[model samples]
Target: MIPAASALARAGHEVLVACVPQLVEEFTSAGLKAVAALPDQAECWAEITDTGHDQVIKVVVGQRLLARGYPELRKVAAWFEPDLVLRDGMEFCGCLVAEQLGIPHVAAPSGAVNTLAPAAIAPLLNERRAEFGLDVQDDPLAIYRYGRIDSLPPRYSFAARGIPRAVAYRQPEASDRCEPLPSWITELDPGKPLVYGAIGVALPTAAASRDGGKASTIPADPVRALAALVGALSELDCTAVVSTGGVSFPRAGVPPHVRLVEHIAQPLLLQTVQLFVTHGGYNSVREAVRAGVPMVVAPLFGDQLDNARKVAELGLGEQATAPSEIAAACRKVLGSSENLARARHAQRELLALPPVDEVARRLALLASAR
Candidate 1:
C-alpha cells in the first residue's frame, strides 16, 4: 500500500492513510499523511501473525478486527470526506464506509489474490454489515465493488474464479535508494557467486528478546527452517548474505561463507545476486522476477505456498519443503539454463505492463467519475 499511496500522491492526489497508531510513523516516514483511526488500540491486528490458528479462529480474529476498526474508520471518513477509498484487500472498513457514503472504493491486493478471497471472509463480513443496517451481499466479492488494481501479470495472479473488474499494473523493480551497504559486505570474496536469502519481516519477533531481558528466539519451526537454509547454503562455494529478520543467532555458529544481519535493503541486494532463496511472498517473487533472478522457494504460510507453486509452474524457479531438500533445489535452479531463460522472460513480461503512474491516473478518473 505504501508504493500505491506514494504513486497516488505523486500523481497530485491529496491522500491521508487512516490506520492504527502503530503504523502512523511508517506512513509518515514514506512522506504520506496518516491519521490514527484506531488510537485506543496499541495493536489491533496482531492476531494476523498467529499462523497456527485454525480457519475458524482466523475468521473470528478477522471479524473482530473489522468490527473494532469500522466505527473508528467511519469517524475518520466523516471528517475526511474522501471522494474514494483505497484499501488493501484485507481491509474491509474502506468498502463499508464507501458503501455508506455512495463513493467508489478500490481493492488493492498486497499479495496474491488467493490470500484475499471473498468466499473465505464474506460470511463474517456480511454478519458485520447487517449490524450496521446495511444490506447483505450475495456475491462474496462485492467488497471489490468499484474494481481492483493488481500488481502482478495475469499469469502470476491467484485471483478467484469470479472478480468484478481488475487492472494489471507491473510493480517497478526494486530501486537503489542510495542506502550504504554494511562495511562487512564490501569485504566478501568477489570471486564467488553471491546468493541472497531472507524470510521477510512478517515473521513474529520475540519481544522478550528484543528487550534487554534475553536474546530473541524465533519460533521453533521457523528457526529450524532458517537453520536448514543457512546450513544448506554453507555447503555451497558461493558467498551467501542472509538476513535473519531480527532472529538472534550465535555468531560463532554461522559459517564464515555466510553473512548474517537483522535487515538488508533487499532491492539493492537483489541487483547483483545470482540466485534468491525466499519464502515466496508476492513482492519478493515479483522483485526477483524483475531482476531476472531465479529462486528456490521455501514457503512457510498463507499464500506463500501458492506463490511457490507458481514459481515452479512458471519455470522461474523450484520449491523445496524440507531443509534437507533446499540445497538441491537451489542447486537445480541455479544450474538450470531453462530457469534462467524463464526468469529473463518474466522480466520482459513485467517490463511490458503499465506503470504505477497509469494506475494512479485510472484511480483519479474513478474518483472523479459521477
Candidate 2:
C-alpha cells in the first residue's frame, strides 16, 4: 500500500492516509500525509494461520474492529471530504464511510479476493452499516463499486462471479528499499544453483524450550516448518539463502550450506536466484513471476493455497506440502524447461500491464467522475 500511495502522491493527488496512530510514522516517512483514524485500542488483526473454519472467525474479528473504529473514521472522512476512497481489500471502514458520504470507493488488490466468499462477510458488514445509519448492503462486494486495480497475471488470478470492475496493473520492483548486492550474495559460487527461501512476514515465532527460548502467541508452527525447509535445502548441492521472517532460531542448527537472515530484499534477490522457495503469498508470487524465477510453493494458509494451486496449474512452479518435499520440488522446477518457459511467459504478461503512474491516473479519474 505504501507503493500505491506513493504512486498516487507522485501523480499529484492530495492524498491523506487514514490509519492507526502506530502506522502514522511509516506513512509520513514515505512522504505521505496521514491522520490517525482510529484510537490506539483498535489493534490490527493478527495473521491468519488457520485457513479453515477459523478464517471466518478472523474475518468477523476484522469487521468488528473496523466497526469499533467507524466513528473515528467517519470524522476523518468528513474532514478530508475531497474525493473517492481507495482501500485495501480487507478494510471495510473506508467503504462504509464512502457510502455514507455518497462517494465512490475502489478496492485495491492486497490478496486473492476470491478466497473468502462475499456472503461470508455480508452479515458483519451490514451490521456495521446499520449502526452507521446507512442502508444495509446486501452485496458484500459493494466496496468495490468503483473497481479494483489488479497486479496479478490472468492465470494467477482467481475465477469468481460478481467480481467488481477492475484494471490490470504491474507491480514495480522494490528499488527504493533495495541495497547493493551483499558480499555473501556476490561471493556465492556461480557453478552451484542459488536458491532463496522465505516463509513470509506473518510466520509464527519460535516456540519456548527448557533452555529459555521465546514463544509466540500465534498458533502456527512456522519454526518447525522453516527448519524443515532449510534442512531440505541444505541436503541439496545448492547455496541457499533462507529468511527467518524475524523469528529467531538456533543458529547452530542451520546447515553450513545455508545463510539465514531475518530479512532481505526479496525483489532484488529474485533477480539473481535460479529458484525461489516461498510460502506463496500474492506479493512473493507476483515478484517471482515478474523476475522470471520458477518457484517451489509451500503454502501454509489463506490465499497461499490458491496461489500454490495456480503456480502448479500454470506450470510456473511446483507445490510441496512438507519440508522434505521442497528440494525435489525445486529440482523438478529447475530441471523442467516447461516450468522455466511458463515463468518467462507469465513475466512478459505481467510486464505488459499498465505501469503504476497510469494506474494512479486512472484512479484520479475515478475520483473526478464521482
Compare the candidates by TM-score and give the number of the best one: 2
| Candidate 1 error regions (>4 Å) | 39-61, 158-165, 182-191, 204-222
**Pairs with backbone N, CA or C atoms under 3 Å apart (clashes), candidate 2:** none
The lDDT of each candidate is 0.76, 0.76
Candidate 2 accuracy as TM-score: 0.89
lDDT of 2 by residue, 180-253 (tens): 66777888888998999998865542233211442233435777878888887888888999998777677886
lDDT of 2 at 335: 86
Task: Give model 2 RMSD, 1 decimal.
Answer: 3.4
Per-candidate TM equals 0.88, 0.89
Q: Which tens-of-lDDT digit does each residue in 67-153 have in candidate 1?
A: 777888898888888999988775677788888888999988766454555676677778888987778889876787788987767
| Model 1, C-alpha of 196: deviation from truth (Å) | 0.9
- Candidate 2 whole-model C-alpha lDDT, 0 to 1: 0.76
